[model samples]
Target: MALARGFADPVHDAQAVFRTVMDALARPGLVRRLACGLAPPAPLTPELAALALTLADADTPIWLDPSLAGCAAVSAFLRFHAGAPIVANPAEAAFALIADPGACPPFAAFAQGTPAYPDTSATLILALARLSEGRGLGFAGPGIRGRAQLDAAPLPPDWPERLQANHAAFPRGVDLVLTAPGRVAGLPRSAQALVPEEA
Candidate 1:
């Protein structure tokens, strides 16, 4: 498809998406909207579409859980422009894009840091919904003096526990990007994640 026929050229759109991600990461926990242009296959939202364009590149190897694989056409798209390799498992992935964070596997199932190279852990980009500030919960850690509230939806039942376990490893847990329609918030492995107390 050509940009001439109501189809946006991906390379052109990727630039804007890149800016969104770069700035979002630079600021941490801030919300920024990204553009989504892919005529993405099923189970894909604009959030996930924009993310695939922005973060994937030649140097990265991405692992897509079953939820995301039908678009190998998109995979071919990545290989052509970004040269990013697609891998079979999370352990082999530099970046893992999760379509449904709620049902996504535990952090332990994916790669954590090795003693020699703690930074080897994965970077997870999660496509989420109901993006709002973590208004009710008190969140603290790097980049905040006391407690900072940012939008953080609840993950799986054990996700909070898993994140705590990941944090205990410090420089080892995966870095995260939580995204919605057009906005995103990052939870660097350095940040402490606390689930809200239910009312």
Candidate 2:
């Protein structure tokens, strides 16, 4: 099978994507656009593919959700572009790409860093259909002033509950980076996802 093309300018594109990702993580619910123009394999959206290319490296172990894992093209793309090793064990993954959020396990299922080394925990990159503003989960935490709203749908009904658990775990929990067609958002473990009643 022919491999797809990655970033047009590898260095600058990766740096651009990395900066956008960091900005999103710094301000929960904030969305940033990416224009790397990468055409990775199926089930790998440009946004997620950009993330993989920007963040994953030979030293980072990646875990793909069932859908992404079963797609040979997707694996090949990651290997060729990201140069990251694919790991079957979620607990061992430095980054976990989730193409099917509904079937994704709870946050606790992945690696939670030790209290002494919180930064070692896994970061989850979720591929969503889209992200909308002003009407989803309420967010508040370090980056947020008072509260912020984000709507990334097609997620499991218990997403808020799961997020609450993730937030409560604090420095030890996995952080989330959500991706749509050309945009991305972050939900760091420090950010709180308020349930409906609390919103």
TM-score per candidate: 0.80, 0.97
What TM-score would you give candidate 1 relative to the actual structure? 0.80
Model 2 TM-score relative to the real fold: 0.97
Question: Which pairs, if any, clash in model 2?
Answer: none
Error of 2 at 9 (Å): 0.5
- For lDDT, the strongest prediction is 2
lDDT digits (tens) for residues 33-144 of candidate 2: 8677987888888888999999999999999999999999999999998899999999999999998887878888799998899989999999888787688889999999
Q: What tens digits encode model 1's per-residue C-alpha lDDT throughout 29-105?
A: 66777666555655656676567666777777888767776666556655554568988878878788788788777
Where does candidate 1 stray beyond 4 Å?
A: 1-15, 134-136, 195-199
Clash count, candidate 2: 0
lDDT of 2: 0.90
* Clashes (candidate 1): 4
Report the C-alpha displacement of residue 82, candidate 1, in angstroms: 3.3
